[model samples]
Target chain A: MTATAPQALATLPLADDALILSHRLGEWAGHAPVLEEEMALANIALDLLGQARALYAGLAEVLGGEDEIAFLREERAFRNCQLVEQPNGDFAHTMVRQLFFSAYQQPLYARLSPVLPLAAKAASETAYHRDHAEQWTLRLGDGTEESHARTQRAADALWRYTGELFQPVEGLDVAWQELAEEWHADIRDVFGRAGLTVPEGPSEGAWSAGAGRQGLHTEPFGRLLAEMQHLHRSHPGATW
Target chain B: MVTGSAPAGRHPREASLTQLAGSVPDPELPVITLAELGVLRRVAEPEPGHVRVELTPTYTGCPAIEAMAADIERVLREEGGAERVEVRTVLSPPWSSDDISEEGRRKLAEHGVAPPRAGARRAGPVLVGLSPTRHTHPAQAPAPEPVRCPNCGSAATELLSRFSSTACKALRRCTDCREPFDHFKEV
Candidate 1:
């Protein structure tokens, strides 16, 4: 709407990542154990959707008025990180993913706030999201043996992917490094309180990960894209 | 319409204030003006040379609410509609997408965001179809109907993500054109 010409794949993953997660969270909407949870996840889903729209819209502008890029781009063309792509295995797994991602995101968004316009605009909602995840983690982790065991398994399963959060993208490194340094202490403190440990760094210490943030995606991405775009691709302009 | 003349002693300020206050659009959907959203409940002269506008959100937890209130205050103050702008949040009678103007829907579609659907008439329980993961609940009347994409106008749109970047829409992609657009998720 603001009318900036669309840029290259520069704004690729951030918005797309949010968009994908929004879709995932939506999967849990009415299915959550309780009505309150159902509403909460649905609320979370809506928030992510909004974030995706703004990012996609911005990306479209940057790409020189290519509105199709937002809707019509192929699967490999999407750049969302893999952590979000993993299935929501169970409530515990869902909480773990949220905890892991929210922990990283709180600081990431906080640091990115000064630089990214939309990040600043989205600060409060992100803060609320972080708070919600932390609250749930503490509830599930500190509860019964089953809850605790599940939470632990969830954490362990997701910890492997935590390293990817630090592996910087091309234009993202400068901001990512600064953010890591700035928020390292805070991230650790929060994790400590929730009985969650800061995941150990990757021994390999490589950042390649093969161009996800640059529109090059994993194999599953194509399937996800196919399902996501099926309706649009099939019917074309068929309206209600 | 009283022509530009103020009642003998007053300045013609409230008129200018209303015009300026009217310029601020709904924060979430920027196309239709807030006035049309029924968000600007009133512009009144509670005191001499002072005008107040009562404002409310379309949804209780809509993220843009705080910003919208601030925007209202800022815009009104800038345009001199009121020396002090008071934004009141009224939640008793919650807002419905039906409140969105016809023009508002057009604007949203033009911007590539689908308009809110007419949600009530065709369904069983209101909440059933909006969410598909609920197996515990029995089958209900099919979801009113699939929502069409505004971009390519495809009714074959699939509910891709129940959550979008904000908390009020779902990410639905048109199956026909593979174009993903935002659907104002029915609450």
Candidate 2:
């Protein structure tokens, strides 16, 4: 079968997560504080891009479409949540974003290795990303007074978004439910290790930004699409 | 984990799968096979003639995994005499530039992409009593002697962007040929 069928991909959740995070990371491509850091962030972005493309390609195969998910859908068709879709703020904000997301991601990936192939791959890369982010967090959080204060501010600003990372989508099967439970416990543990205090804020209900798994999204997605799709949309099937 | 191997001509299928799967050259960097590159970490034959090969990416975002997986399936099916090949991505051991084999590095260099020197010192100076400009110094430093221009055989070249078409390379322009080329960024 070609890439045009409409079958549901098994790894859509992971694919969506990768897609959103890659977009967020790509925003830092040229704007990092240091050149080496720039390279490192770009490398991480590429990793996320790799995961996104593979997952999307797999999704396309299941969905049966000539266009990959990035190219084919309206904004609402995307399944990624708002936290990853939020604009990356300053370096501190970016690090906080990295810290918060990887806290959830690192453990999720660790638990997934024996059970799933894609999860195993995500877990490995995320382990590196987690270490990278955690190091930065401690450096910024416990270092100089200014950096510590700023990191604290960043944490406060971004803490509101953390709840949604573990919030399960409605359609998960039993295996996914079990995985989500493990993900919750594992993520909380990592946060505790990072010296981050888990907020007891109200849970951001499903699709407050809309149901991402079911392809309901918010306003920001349109702008993201325009930039992401500009080349492919402008060139019409052009190959690099 | 094989049992009952009395037949004189029979080899454990897991061993055969591992051997075959490991022998497949990395599509992007061919000097190393998946086994040598650490891309293929393990293989299992849970059922007869159906092999499951586990792989890891060389970089967090290496695009070659898909191609590698396809290639792994193709190579294993042919060599192992298997009806089915299941290639799985194992991400627990994240790939680092360090993972590339010495042979792989040589091949990459021959391919005009400079490979990372083993345990090479980082270009950046550490914090404390270091000039902020220290980080800026290396960008202007002269390209090393063995730096062959991918566009021409001239070693006289100036550094451009450290990141080029991909993160693995840098942009450089040769003075002798006056041609800009991508130098596989030495990790």
Candidate 3:
């Protein structure tokens, strides 16, 4: 089996999701609003990176190498959801995004755990991620007027991008409709408590924004790739 | 869980190798050995002079894993006189705080860190768990035991943050003792 194998190709989307979101979270290293939050986000990023590493390691037999697959892939080759690749607009925006993704990941991993060892292992970590995101979402959405507005705006802005998460990828045999409904119910439950509105956009119907799983991404994904791949590209064999 | 156990008593060579590998102190918490932490899953001499060890991580992204692997290799090569050492990490049946030995729990409490509650985690797939404050279905799951204050042995502890100095720990404050400490929370 090589990189061209269908099984290997199926792996790209899952690995890319963790890796890209991890990079986005790492961008907050020294820039987080407070020390506690800084630690929290970094911890989450580390967890996701660990997952990405494990998934990539499994692919090492099928793919040439983890580094080659991750570092050398062009923009169109990545298969993460567009939602994860979106830039961190604000703290509220980041939290909203985290909430959306973690909510999806928890159930997805739980359902996949029976078949994939990696997925089983990641389910535990995903629980904490969802908790972290939900906590922040509640505080931000129900706080001061500005925070309320910001959180709500972030939710509405990221809503369209979330449909891609439930869209079926070729290799994964998941109950897509069930997963989507669960995700929706989760969002509504959390948003209701936080005093936030569920965005009116069509989440699963045609015209909702998505397609990162198909190697089609939004504009910012290219820049994200440049920054992420720059060091690995420049120092091909550099080791810490 | 048993990979290669025969009908006879354990092999003496394999036992010693397990001890040697398990003796390595955890990279983050020096108070506990890998064996005490229960992350040192297994060690076997599969072939002459070839040592293979399976180590699990408390958290998937625990940075200490690489360090732990390196340390295990160093010990097996220099101390155990192994010509080749290969440390492999295993993730199935993912490491849980319940994996920590009783000795490990005592050490953590003595050092003012609360040990995870035994059996707080059930086997099989499930969420890692959330604070009781914001859980979606509070009535469905039994209430978790209160985290005792390590300093005063009081149950009057409250969560300050779900995350703390390390990923495995949660920041907690003891209302009784007015002391903030880390709870080695259950996974």
Name model 3 segments beyond 4 Å from true. Answer: A1-6, A204-206, B1-8, B123-143
Q: What tens digits encode model 1's per-residue C-alpha lDDT throughout A1-240?
A: 122322345446667777787777878966788654676687877766666765665566555333355457776667777777667889989977876666666565545555454554354456556656766677677677888788878766666556566667545433566555554565566557657656564411363233455555656567667766777668775456
Regions of candidate 1 where Cα sits further than 4 Å from its true position? A1-9, A62-67, A172-174, A181-187, A197-211, A214-220, A238-240, B1-187
Q: Per-candidate DockQ versus the true complex?
A: 0.06, 0.17, 0.50
Order of candidates by TM-score, top first? 3, 2, 1
- lDDT at A52 for candidate 1? 71
Please report, as a residue range, the 10-residue window in candidate 2 chain A with the lowest summed lDDT: A1-10
Interface RMSD of each: 11.2, 7.4, 3.9
Clashes of 2: 17
Tell me the interface RMSD of model 3, in angstroms.
3.9
Local error of candidate 1 at residue B175 (angstroms)? 49
Off by over 4 Å in 2: A1-7, A65-67, A170-200, A203-218, B1-35, B38-56, B64-187
TM-score of 3: 0.92
Q: How do the candidates rank by DockQ, highest first?
A: 3, 2, 1
The most accurate candidate by lDDT is: 3
Error of 2 at B173 (Å): 27
